[model samples]
Target: MTKPTLYLHIGAGKSGSSSIQAALARCAVPLREQGFLVPGDKLEPDATVSGHQLWFFQGLPKDEPESQKKVLRRLLRCKNAMAEQECHSLVVSAENLINRRKFPDLFLDVDKHFRVVVIAYLRRQDQYIQAHWQQWGFKSHPDFDDWIANGLGDIANWDVALADWEAAAFKKQIIVRTFERPKLHGNDVVLDFFNILGLDGKTFDLGNTEQNRGFSELTLRIAERNRDLFDGPHDNRFFAFLGEHLGSVVYEKEGGSIHLGKEDRQRLLDRFRAGNERLRKTYFPDQETLFDESNLPDRLELSEAEWSQREHDLIWRLLFAMHRRK
Candidate 1:
């Protein structure tokens, strides 16, 4: 019997991971028939989401060795189950796995039984930070400067993140791909991910599904003001209601555009310029730059008075929305 192969899509998040995972789940039966099993979908605690967050959580470091021992046992059982089903390929999709410093160590025992492949998708630093900033605002309002200096700012520096994953993967090749559409194999993320797995894109039924749309500027303003009142571990329902109903409202309003200033954006680009160049040369040698910025819309700067007026209007809308909900 041939040994099974395991693919790890350990992510640099906000890189269309949710969509890819959803597609994987949609095609799981067909993929299994084709000898590929996406076990992550089944392992997710919430059937609606398509990530193996529980597996990632199990492997996250804890103070006690017992937790690690239990995780290893669970992994062993999972592998045995896959083998019994005669599945020759298993995919583990978890964006959070990249944050686990002991990434390779988590699978040292499993490697002895199967082939391990590590794959990652990366976006340009400029685009990555912009998208991440929007996502972060959904959960909490953090000052962009402080957020950059602390939370997500360092994540876009691909050189550092990739290097860390490479070191953890031991002898395995870390297959890296750019998230830019033109650079992607099929110019579609789900198709691109499947292409890497040696599957024909035509075989899968990918639906028109959108996941985790970020908060708009007006929504962000409301979230910033009310975070202390309603933000907590169990408030995703409230956030979802705001995003689904009000995200578009913000876009239609005049002067509602909220984004980093040109100076700040340029500073972020400059900070990552040298690192991005290195990454392109190392992974994507065909590209001149990690990102093509010639087509980006010019930033629209709002004066203090304009911003204040916008905020006052947005607050009214927020309060009205809340009152209606009640």
Candidate 2:
């Protein structure tokens, strides 16, 4: 009998992964009808709503041998169930998989059973860093420059990060998609992913809406200031609450969010120029550049006076809003 194909979506985070996962979960029935199995539904029913967290745990630290064994057993059970159900394909998605250094060894059993196709989405490094800073870095490193200087920039080295997966013994192929709006199908990541799966995206129920919402620059600043209140950087509930309440606030001040100056942005890009070029040649030979840079703006740095004033006004507004609410 022919081995089933496994479509593994290893997210380079902040790349609309949540939206994709939600859509996949919602359309589990439709996908199974088409012979594609979303393992979460069969192996862990609750995971269909929360995402493929079960699979994600496999990439966690190797200290929990029992937990790892449990996950492996569940995966094997899913594989057996798929065979019984005559499912020819499987889809397992988890953004955290991108961080797994031992991906090849971890998925050796999976590779033995199914033909593995690794799917990943890559965002421009500058945008990625900015998004990540807002999402998690603010809790630990309030200053964006400090975050980058203190080794966060290393995550943007896609070539280095994906090299191990590329060379993985079981990988049949690796699909690398640029997470830019223009590059996506129908200007949507969900549509782009369905296009990759050779399915009609319009037919699937996309659920209520998109999964994650971005934080405004103002909210990020506030969150950074109050990061100590949270348990840790992963204290998503606090961050989400702040964004939900303050994300839409417009300071209407002289300066916008703190962004890397033109020179600094160019330097950051230049730092990874060689590796990006190599990636472009190897995966996207048809394209001249790995990322489209035509629309990037040269944001000016805010003067200290302007920044201080903006912060003062923002705090006053927030305090007044809270007082009124009470």
Candidate 3:
């Protein structure tokens, strides 16, 4: 029997991961026919982005003994399924896998089943922060300034993260792809991933939808102020409706760009410059720069008081929307 191949899409985060996971789940049956097995539907249905999340969650350090026992069973089940399918390759994708320091140890549990390959996509540092902040700001008070001061280092420092993953014992070849659309193969991440795997597009049902669109700063600020209202269990349905409606309402006004103060932008660029350069030289010798920085914009042209007024107005509108839902 041919040794199976295991491909792990370890995301650099905020780089279209939801879309990729959805694509894999959507095309599972067709993929299996082509000898690629993406197992996880038993833990989560293919309709959701967390379809392959069990593999990632199981890999993390767990405090509960019962849960740890389940992890081994899960791995054994996956191996058996692969054997039954006669699959030559298996793929498990999750953004959390990219930055997890204990990544190598996590895969040691299943390394005997297959040869491992790590695939990742890196986004521009500035864009990565804005995208991440907007997502978290919707659920909590992801203070932008605080993130810049404390969280930026890990998120922006691709070199360190990549280096650690490369050093991991389970890692075979690490395929690094830039998240920029123009730079991506066929201008689509899903297609580009298929290219990396050398899979025939006609062999799989390659359908996809855009997922996790970024919220505007104004929308995020409003969401942050009212985070308590949506944080509880009662708010899940309400937020689901809000997420759908808000996209259309904000679509026209959204510039699709996160504004940062010129000084702050320069600070971010300078901070990541050496690290990004080293990353490119180490992994992408042909590329001069890891990311494009020419079009970064200055902060939104609004004073604090004016921005606060807008927040108040947005809160009122949000309350009205909730009332209308009732």
Candidate 4:
């Protein structure tokens, strides 16, 4: 039988992307038996984020297609692996990939020879904007406002970035998820997601958040201090030399209280409401009202001293693990 194929997921970043990626990586063996082919045992490089490898600057000249083509060349190599393996379906799960203006153009290239579908998750805009800001802040961003003015600050209109997925005519080809529901735990979400790809889950590991879940204020500050540190490949070495120091620098306690404020938050929330309405009109109903903010963990609870101890302990443990691996 000719191996049928589908690109099962086109992600919305920070919406449990790490967990989903972790689940697929852990269950590679079982997933293969079911005819799905995920990438091999390696973390794929992210070209778009702070490290600057993807070269997705908004105002780059059209004559400078060379920059984007470099990224596409790498993607083609990955696509070749999927086709050669003759796996049932493939999921291209990078949130930033869909954030580009050329999403439809890019998908057309894939659908020329393969079936393609997009899977995405949504969080309320107000909450997500704040979370997204805090995430960027975790990188030790000194001038946080500048980062917001340029980068994900406009993410409330992220669908606008992708030419709005609905405008791409992916009605039957896309999956949109809201993060409000609790059952969407990393593995459980994928188990439910599998039905869309004609997949089924089996005995597998839990979510990958165990090691990197909590973000203390202290840890977030450390991350922001040397923001541009851990990034990109170094001569085919997947565990680049710089990333080796992530434990030394980052920790669950580094993140302090978020300060996006009530006024700024309200503005962002209003934008999200507009976008959410647009999304529901095109896709599902307005079932997004279910997310209640009262249940979220308090962000300002951790003191500096408490977080510093946690940071030191986690880093010490990580250094020991790395030493043992050597």
In model 1, the clashing pairs are: none
Off by over 4 Å in 3: 41-50, 54-59, 63-73, 137-142, 151-153, 170-172, 232-239, 251-253, 256-259, 303-326
TM-score of each: 0.80, 0.84, 0.81, 0.65
Give the root-mean-square deviation of each candidate in angstroms: 4.1, 3.5, 4.1, 6.9
What's the lDDT of the predicted structure labeled candidate 1?
A: 0.66
Clashing pairs in 2: none
Model 1 residue 77 CA deviation (Å) reads 2.5
**Residue 260 error, candidate 1, Å:** 1.2
**Which wins on TM-score, candidate 1 or candidate 3?**
3
Worst 10 residues of 1 by lDDT: 40-49
List the candidates ranked by TM-score, beginning with the highest: 2, 3, 1, 4
Compared with the true structure, model 4 gives a TM-score of 0.65
Q: What is the per-residue lDDT of model 3 for residues 8-41, given as tens digits with 9 covering 90 to 100? A: 7888667878778787878888787787777773
Tens digit of lDDT per residue, candidate 2, span 28-48? 888888877786633442245
Pick by TM-score: 1 or 2, better one: 2
lDDT of 4 by residue, 52-84 (tens): 111233333454355355435544555566557
Clashes of 2: 0
Q: Quick one: best TM-score, which candidate?
A: 2
Q: Which candidate is the best by lDDT?
A: 2
